[model samples]
Structures are given as C-alpha cells and as structure tokens.
Target chain A: MSSDPNSTSNAAAKPADGLNDVHTLSLVVRDRPGVLVRIALVFARRGYNIGSLAVSPGAAGGFARMTITSQGNPETLEQIIKQLAKLVDVVHVADHLEHPPLEAEIALVKVGVGEGSDRNQALHEVALEFNAVVVDRGKATSVLRLIGSRDELQAALSALAPFQVQELVRSGSVVMDKGRSVLTDLLQKS
Target chain B: MKASVDTGAQRLIRFLEHAGVEYIFGLSGGAAMPIFDALVDSRIKLILTRHEQGATHMADGYARATGKPGVVLVTSGPGATNTVTGLLTALMDSVPVLVLTGQTPTFNLGKDAFQEADVTGITYPVVKHSYLITSAQELPRVVKEAWHVLTTGRPGPVLVDLPKDVTQGPCDAPEPETIDIPGYRIPSLPDTEALDRAATALGQAKRPLLYVGHGAVISGAGEAIAALSDKLQAPVVNTLLGKGAVDETGPLHLGMLGMHGTAYANKAVVACDLIMSIGGRWDDRITGKVDAFCTDAVRLHVDIDAAEFDKTVTSHIQLLGDARRTVEALLPRVRPGDTGAWLAQCQAWREQFPLTFESPDDDHLRAQHVLSRLNALTEGKALMTTDVGQHQMWAAQFCLTRANRMWLSSGGAGTMGYGFPAAIGAQFARPDTPVWAIVGDGGYQMTLCELATACVHKLPVKVLIINNNYLGMVRQWQELFFENRLSGVDLEGNPDFVKLAEAYGAKALRISHPSEIDDVLSEAIAYADGPCVVEASVVKEDNVFPMIPAGAAVSEMLIERPTEKLEKPSGST
Candidate 1:
C-alpha cells in the first residue's frame, strides 16, 4: 500500500519465499450492523490484525458483502473461516489468495504529459490499450484511472512516466473470487 | 405505541441518541445508508457534509469544544478512507470521537464488491479502538462499547463499522452489559507506595515544576493540576494541549513548554531539582534532547497509560492513575517548599525570552496585536481556538486563558485548519462562552467550509482570520533555510473572507490597520447574534520567535526575542 520500505522492501528483497506459513483469507459476510465488528472482534479477541478488508452492497435487497482478508496458518485460517461462517449475517468465508479470483485495486495516477499531444497521445493510446479511463485532464497533468493487479498498475505507471509524473491515488485492493454463484450463494444464505 | 420493527442500523442510532449525542457529522453512501435512513426523524440532528474530511473535522471540532465524544458517520470504502486524517488528529490531540461508518454487505464479502475498503485494518494503529458490528441484535451493546472506549482511558477516536445488511436486518436491541475488554478498563488509583515515593521526592526538592497535558482537560482535572501546583508552591508549565490547565494569568505559572515554548518555562523545566509530570508524556518536543533534558532533576511521571512511563525519559517515581485522583491522593503528603533563588532563575529566563512581536505600532495591523486585544476583550472568558503554525503558537503565547477548558487547539498533531473546526466544537461544547477561532491565512482555508456549519447552527463564534497571504510558517522556514527561495508557499489570491462570511449569513468585519483592532473586536463580539468573521490583514514577513530551531534541545531555545530587534531596528524606520 504505502511506499514505506519497511514492509514491501523486506518482502521484495527476500528471495526465500515459501509462503512463509502465511495465507490470506477473504470472507464475504452480509453487510449488517455489527457484522464487521463480530467478525473483527473474533479476530481481535484472538489478537489478530486483519491483513485487509473490502466491503460493498450486492444488487439484491438487504444484503452487502464485506471481503475480509486476514493472515494466519492453514489451521488458524480454517478455524477463523469456520467461526466467521457461524456469524449470524456472514454468508460465506473463503481464502481468496489460494483460490481462483478477480483481484485488483483502482488507481488514479496523475501523469504530466510534457508540452502537448505527442506525450498525451502516446499515454492516451497506452491507456486505451489497457482499458483505463482518463478521470481528470489538465494542461500540466492527466489523472489516468487504472484498475488491475498491483503489478500491472505499477508496470503501467512506470511505463507512462517517460513524461513527468505528478501524483497518484490507489483505491485500495478489492477482490472477488471466480464464479457468479458466490454472490448468489451468500445472498441466499442471508 | 405503534412501533416499527427497527433494523440494526436504527438500533445503533437509537443507542447514539440515548447516549446523548445531539449531532453526527458525516456523509451517507451504500454501506451506511440504512443508518442515515433511520436518522431521518430521529432526535439527533445529522449535518450532511460535502466530504468525509469535513465530517471528521466537524466531529473533531465538536469534541474539542464540548469535552464529550464527537460523532462522525460515513459510508465504507472511500468514505472510511477519507476520515483517516481526522482520526489521526483526534488520536494526537487525545480528543474522544466516535466514527460510525458503513461497511459493504456481508453477502458481497471478499468478492470485491464496489466501494469496499479495509477500514478497521487501516485504522487500527490510528484509533484508540475500532468495532465492526456484525449482528443486528448486538447494535446497542456495540455502540455503548464504542462510547465507553472513546470516553474512558486515554481519550481518542473509536470506529464502528456497520454493514448495510446488518442495518436493514430485523433484530431486538441487545441490552448494554460489561463485556470483558481484555486489557482496558478505567484504571484504578495509583499504588500507595508509588504515591508516597512521589510525594517524598516532591517534598525534598528545592524547585519542582508541574508539567500538564490535554489528559488533565479530558479527565476533568484542570483544577487539580492548578491545586497541586499551588499546594506545593511549584510553578506550572503546560504542554500545548494543556493550555488552560492553569489560568494563564495566575501566579506560579511559567507558561507552555515545547519547540515554540517560552524560555522561562523551558529553563524552569531544565533547572528544576524535581520535575513532576502530570497528565503528559514529556514528549520530545517538550524535552528537546531526551538525554540532556532536566539532567539535574529527579523526574516523576504520572499518567493513566502505563506504557508512557520510561518510554522517553527515565522516571524516579511513576504513578499510573487518573490525574485528578492521583493529585488528590498525593496532596496530603505534599508540603510547601521555598526556592527563592530557583524562582528568580526561572523568572530571569522568562524575562530573557519574552514572546514579543516586531511590528511597528505606526500603521500595519499585526497578528500579535490582535491577540493582545483579544486577551483584553475576553478578559480570559473567551475560549480561544488556534490553528497550527505562527498563529497557534502566538495564541498560546499571548492569550490569557482564565477559565478551565477555555483554550482549544490540536497540540500533538499540530494540524493546520484545526482551529476553525475545533472552535466550532468548543462553541458546541460551551455555547455561552465567547469562542474565537483564531487562524492564519493558510490554516483558515483548510476547514473553511465549516464556517457554514457554525452559521447554520447559529453558534455565536467569532472567527478572527489573521490573513497574511502566505503559508506564513512555511515562508518563515524558506526565509531561514532556503535563503528565501519561496515557492508554492505564497497564497496570492484569497477569497474575500468578509464577503464569504456575509454569503454564509454572518456578520463580517475587516481590519487592515492597527487603529481598527479594538473597534472591530468590540464590534464582532457585540454583533455575535449568530456568528461573525473578523479578518485582520497582517504582514506576511512576520515570524514567531524564541523558537527551539526544530531539532534543538529545550534548554537551547533562542533565549532572546528576535521580534524586539526588528521593532528597534538599531534606530528608526
């Protein structure tokens, strides 16, 4: 998330990557009062800082899904999943990292396009190729909106910056596991 | 009673109102709309803000003003993310705030639903505590818990994330009960032995200094700090947060100590044989160089948070308890001491570095001149609000705070634009007190939108805008460090503040000359049926002096007033 070198730098520099006995669990629970609290309190009372959490309402009546990503070993993660499922409004709890899923965060990167269209056109073409939106445009900078994997967004940003770059804002990571039935099954359970 | 089957969201709002929350500042979106829907006809008034940042600062202002928990609500994802800055302000200032945010629906969980963000995870380090309400039935208990967490212990902001489904779900409101809070509870009194040890140390010292912080104000122990100082004949020094801990005009009061601290207060702290720290953690700003700070003194630290002990400075006697209770308990053991020479030394230091402005009295209106007039006008009844930078330090240095809880400003965070919202909060807290939000040109713009809230609320707060057309603090830095290569710091085009106030339906007064200061101040105070704005155009080059020069030790502060030299100028302007 942050360019704070402490966490990311350590992860990037280390070549030895054997999962680290860690797994990311993404759970979808019905968006209701205290549902997030119940899930979080369970983790908190057990002394766990959730790795990530993303939540939004579904297209149905009286149901929203909160995607909770937490770090633990297989056994602990399984226990948490089981406990989360037991929650009154929590419809489903699954580990999204290991399973097939759609994962990406939206980033609005403000890139400076030099003097004119040569740089702007090149960047605009690249954005079109990548299906990105130009949310903000100005003489000095254009905020190109990109929604994709962290790696992909970073790659695009690096490539787009042959011209001067101004500012960047990433809409933190949001993930949806593969298959249409996930939302349905969770809503039905609710 | 023809009652509706209320959802978890309604129950939460009901609990909030039951807890005596009159207002909730926030924005409504998908995950949290159910709560907003429930709030439509409720007793609690909701001020819909343009942005989450606005709500957070509004709540921040409300809390700083009222001495009660400020309440804010926002939708999940961007809504929750937007409030991070405000939460940090509350955390740093030790102001209690309750943030109610909507989370994405449970069914859409982890599937990366639209507008979903990890609120609790992101806010964990920043807040005192955070709660995510899962069950509709548990809404009452969760809200009650949040209020309790926000008010008790070292006060700070607490987050309650309510999912939309949970808000709409049908359930009976759960009764409030004491659930085991693992490690936190309102702490008991300090150990008798620790109290005795501290009292003994205080009794023997030749010169003792009592340092207080915002914790005193939060614990309702401002009187106790003053009492303890008087009882022991010890001079009082305050952290920026502890401005009104002792009446600014009272005897045995040196003044605020920190980076921009008075020279006397810093010297008193450094020269003291016994340093009794109450309600504050002797932070780096106060201590300067930790190793050398008060080397001759035996330190006594008392606070509710035990972790603060020995985290920075070594403490000979550490007491963990409420400031009021601890001071009360230690009173019987304390005996008066005489240190004429020590007092003389402290007064010498104070006279050496008096905070004086360099502005000529011939014409131009200076910020300090306004502060002086403000002090005289209010006669210490005014609740002074200060934004960060030259204006904030100036207000703290010059304002004669006579009443307890009269000075409100963000100290630990030193947030710019905080003065406006904080003044709004303080006015909300004490509606009768003459609240003034003193701000510089730069900081005034940060939460300028809150002026509308004050006008709407009909709060009779007087806004004193010290317009200098520059980020005066940053420009001051450029003058000293960058050799005056000022860029981006200059704010040339500013809105017509007087007209802006009129647009918001408030009385406006503009003062461009020194002659108009007294008249405008009196006029603003008298015309304050609702709210009023007084813009005083000050010189941009004016610099607040007797500075610690950033990384300098507390003892090494510039001992002479630079402004005095500017005023004298070695013979006439």
Candidate 2:
C-alpha cells in the first residue's frame, strides 16, 4: 500500500511469522454502487489477502451483508477489522473468530469424461461420503452439489479435482454466531 | 407544506437553505447552468471565482475560518478536474467542504458527451465520500448524507455530483427532513478509560510535550489545550497546520515542529519522555523517521478518526473521539503536573538555535523583516492565509496569531496557489475582519486571477505578494540537496503583478525599497474599500533557517547555512 517500511508501523505491518489462524468478518453495508469495490479495496490496498468473500442483499432490509475471510496474526488482524469499520458504507464489522459461528458453504462440482472415465465410480463414492447429491448428468459431465461446512466443501472439491473437473462454483463461507444473537441484534447495538 | 421549488437544482438550493449554507464559491459553466439558475432565487451568496480551482480553495478557506463546512459548485469536465488539487488540499488538512459538481447526463455518462467526466472515480481517493446522483429525488438525500459525512468524524471534502439531466429533470418530492442514515451513525462517545490512562501518563511524566496538530484548531479546543499546557507547565509544539492552535505569544510555546521547524521544537520532540499528540496526524514531515521521532516517548494519540489512530506514530494509548470532547473530558481527570526542568532544557535549546534570518543583501527586502512588520501592523488581529514555499515558512515563523484558527494554509498537501483565493473566502466569512494573503511569486501566479473575485465582491482582503522571482521552496531544496542544479525553477517572464491587480479593478501597490515597507504595509492594512495587492520583490536565494534537513534527528539541526563542506544527516527515519 505504502512503502512505509517503518518498524514502528501499525500491527498490520507484521509479516506472517507464526500466524496460522484465519479470521472471518461479517459486515452489513449500504446496498449502493461501488460499495463492494470500496470494501474490497480496503483489503486489497492494505496488503491483506482475501481468502474468500460473499455478498448478498439482506432479505428484509435495503442493506447488504458481506462476509470476508483472511489470515493474519491477531495483532495485524485487529488492524484490518478496525480499518474496515472506518469505511462509510460499512455499518458493522463483526469478527467471527471469538463467537465461532455456525459456518456453511455450497459448492457445485462438474466432473468431465475422457481421462477420468474410469474414476467416475470413485468420484460418486467421494460425493456420497460428503453427503453430496448428483444434481445434473450428461454423457460427459456430472454436476454434484455439496452442501456442508466450508472445510467439507473444500475437501469434496479437492477430491473431484483429480477427475478433470469441468467447472467449479463455490459459495463462499457465511457464518452466524452462537445461538439467540441474530445479526439484527448486532446492528441494533451498534 | 407544498415546496416552492420543483426543479432538481432548486431542490438542492432548498436543501442548502435548510443546512444553513451562506455561500457557494463557484464558477458558471455549461453543465452547471441549472445550479447557477437556481442561485438567482436563493438567499445563499454565489461567490464567483475566475477559476474552478480558486473556487474550491475559497471553499476550503471558508471552512477553516468559520468552522463550518464550505460549499462549492462547479461544472463538469475540466471544472470538475480542476477541483482535484483543492480537494486534495482540503482532504489532507481535514477541512470539511461540500463540493457540488455537474456531470454529464446519465445516458451521456459513457458516451463521452460534451463537458463529461468521471469525476466521482477520480476523486474517490481524495474525498471523504462522493456520489453521482442518478435521480433528482435522490439529490436531497445525497446532500444530507454528504453533509453528514463531511462534518462528522475526521471531516474532509465530500462531493455530490449532480448529473446535468438530473438537475434539469422533473422528479418526486424531496424526502422527510430527519436524515437518519441507518448505516452512518455518529461514532460512539469516546472511551473514558483510555482518556484516564492518558491523563495519568501526563500526570506522572517528568518530561512531557503537548504535541498539538490541526485537530486542536478544527475541534476548536484551543482553551482546553491551553489549559492542559498551563496545568502541566509543559512546552507546546505545533505542526504547520496546527500553527494557531494556541496563542503564539505563550511563554512555553515552541512555534512549529518538522522539516522547517524551530530547532527547539524538534529537540523537544526527541528529548521528551511523553508526547501527547492532540488531533494532529503525525505526517511524514513531522516524523522524519517514524521510529526516531519521539522514539523514547510514549505517544498518547487523541483523534476523532480511528484510522488516524496509531497509523503513523504508534501510540501507547489511543483515545478515539472528537477533539473538543476528548480534550474536555481529560481536563478534569488530570492534575497539574510538573515539567519545570524539562521546560528549562527546552528553553536552553530555543536560545541555542533561535529561528533567525540573515541580513538582507543590501536593499533586497528580507522576507522575515516584511513578515515581522506585517505581524505588528495587524497585531495578530487578521486572518492570515499563506501559500506553500518560503513565504509560508516566513509567516509560520514570524506571524503572531492571537487565537486559534486565525491562520489558514495548505499544510498537509503543500499545494501552491492556495493563499490568495483562500483569503477571499476568509474575508467573506468574516466581513469586517482583516485578512492577509501572503504568497510567493510562483505560487501566487498560479491563482492570481482570484484578485478579480475579491474586487467584484469588494472583499477588502489584503494580498501580500512576496515576489522572489523563483519557485522559492523547490529552489531552496535544490540548493541544499540537489547540488544547486536550478532547472525550471526560475520565473523569468513573471508579469507585473501590480499592473495585473490594477487591471482586475483592485487597488495595487509595489514596494522595492526597505524604507517603504512599513508605510506600504500600513496603507494596505488601512485600506477599507475593496481588496488590495502589495507586491514586494524580495531576496531571491534567502533560505529559511533552523532547518532539520528532512530526515535528520532533532539534534542535527543547523541554524545557519554551512560555510564549510556539507555532510548530509545520517540515518533515515
């Protein structure tokens, strides 16, 4: 972002020395043009690598919800969350690391024929292990939907990758913290 | 109640009226005709300027002087582009301004129609917030939101871009008055615990310094800051934008700290154990090398914006809140701390490397002398605006401002041509008050067309054009750091500034001899009619003294130009 190599730079300036933990942040923002770009830019400009991002319009309100995941040390991670909270479009940024929400993801894996023709049975076996269901099928392609936690979906996609995956569509992770505390409550307190 | 105004631009005018805007510094152009037409029937004054850049600077100046968000109106294309520099200037200085720009029609946006521009895209990085209004009904909401964004935490320039067709189109009625943006709530009240920690730290430190920044002035916490300074017996050092945050005549005041700062201020920064930075961004200029700047000190940063907190200078305690409120809360929690020995040490440093100027080379007017005389004539009663370069440093060093917010300059961006037009805005803000525009020859030429604006409005701002015949600051840098290459720094074909002012129907005077300094300045100050321009050809190569040479430590300061071989300061910040 800046050539600011100052040792006294903020916590975000720390290199990933022993950082192994990843954090997910949920944000409620105005459903306006360039809102996503502005939020994405904060992550991009500050050298924070975004592992995943998902934005969906709120069901009841005119606002939109954004869930972003990135890995950094707690020191650096807090700085990123603070920076995100500063954006005008961003209403609230709740770090899910503390609450450890019920995470879910939906992935669609399309497997092709030719090289992986013999592995069709193996792929079906892998899908069954992950509770995936075959949604579409043709002579050369098989589309399966894997609905589970982010890790389960990622493992299922990896299992099918070796079988010549024709295409992959992943719905990024979305999390809601432990029981009774809805996102609306978070918005209300803020 | 049925509204009298139905058109988009008329609705915008009605919104501004509700917002209590007094002036809209602007220029008329093809795309902005709707706004100009609406101005005819509104109570708000339209301060017409010769250039769009001048219009933005005037708005910035008005904001700084009045502590209210200044409003600007400009057409699309070049008029919108022209505001980039002024907007950057305001953004860097944290001046709140509502910039209204006309854009091409929605349908004409991507087709490159006449007077079209991607103004919103261009200013996204420099503005606090911006919008390209798609519909006329959204104008009121955008206006309300823009004002909310501009005047709130860490206020900067916000733009509400009105499409030409939208301004001309018919639309639904404006929304209800209570503009409660669900997404944008005012920041929570400041943390008292953090303030308590900061107060305790101040109470215990043996050597503490009140490092004031522009936030002190922006928050109008001059009295609170002064009270803290008094209670602690701590010396006060200000950044350039924070110049008038406290009375310059205070005994414990260290004028300014940074590249061209007083030796004592820089030395105090290095020696102090606790640096309480109030509302000031620790800009690159202030903290030469961040690690070395107040390296040993515990920084207590108080700012309204959390982004500014610990962004540059790492703070031991960050009190994120409005400047005025933060200071007010701290006033009662802390006791009168003692730093007498530290004050004495700082006094010793001040005496060791006093900010002084060499005697003028014969009859060439010394900038310092002229500034000193100006300071005395105004008696610290005038609103002073300075352009970037040597004259600005001279004013910052020599001028005595009696109160906070009395001085305005493009400090953070260091933009040239800000002073003259800014003076015009300051004059309008305080109609009967005296205002001075001290600008260098090169910077002055960039926006001298604004003299016409002052004349037409009869603003009565005193313009002090310090004609040094060169881009003085850059030339000074070239001399000290660039081996005196002196390429493209000269203003050889500069106009006769006095004649230029006279042609613009403004009173003009030229002073060359040293003897005429007092009389010419006195007459210019006494003039009660329209604006006046006083151009004095000054020493060309005179350098500002007590400079710390960019990245040098506070100890490595030089009061006078080195006569022997020069050695650059060691260690980058």
Best by lDDT: 2
| Per-residue accuracy of model 2 over A141-176 as CA lDDT, tens digit each | 888999998888878877877778888888889887
Per-residue lDDT tens digits for candidate 1, residues B472-565, read: 8877767765667898898988999999889989889998888888898999888757889999988778777666655455666665433322
Which numbered prediction scores highest in DockQ against the true structure? Answer: 2
Angstrom error of the Cα, residue B76, model 1: value is: 2.3
Off by over 4 Å in 2: A1-23, A44-51, A71-80, A97-100, A115-117, A147-154, A180-184, A187-190, B1-5, B170-175, B187-189, B361-363, B562-573
Residue ranges of candidate 1 with Cα displaced over 4 Å:
A1-190, B1-4, B560-573
Expressed as tens digits, the lDDT of each residue in A46-118 for candidate 1 is 5667765667776555656555556544434544565565443555566665565677878888787657667
lDDT of 2 by residue, B344-403 (tens): 899898888787876655567888989988998898899999999989998998997768
TM-score of chain A of 1: 0.66
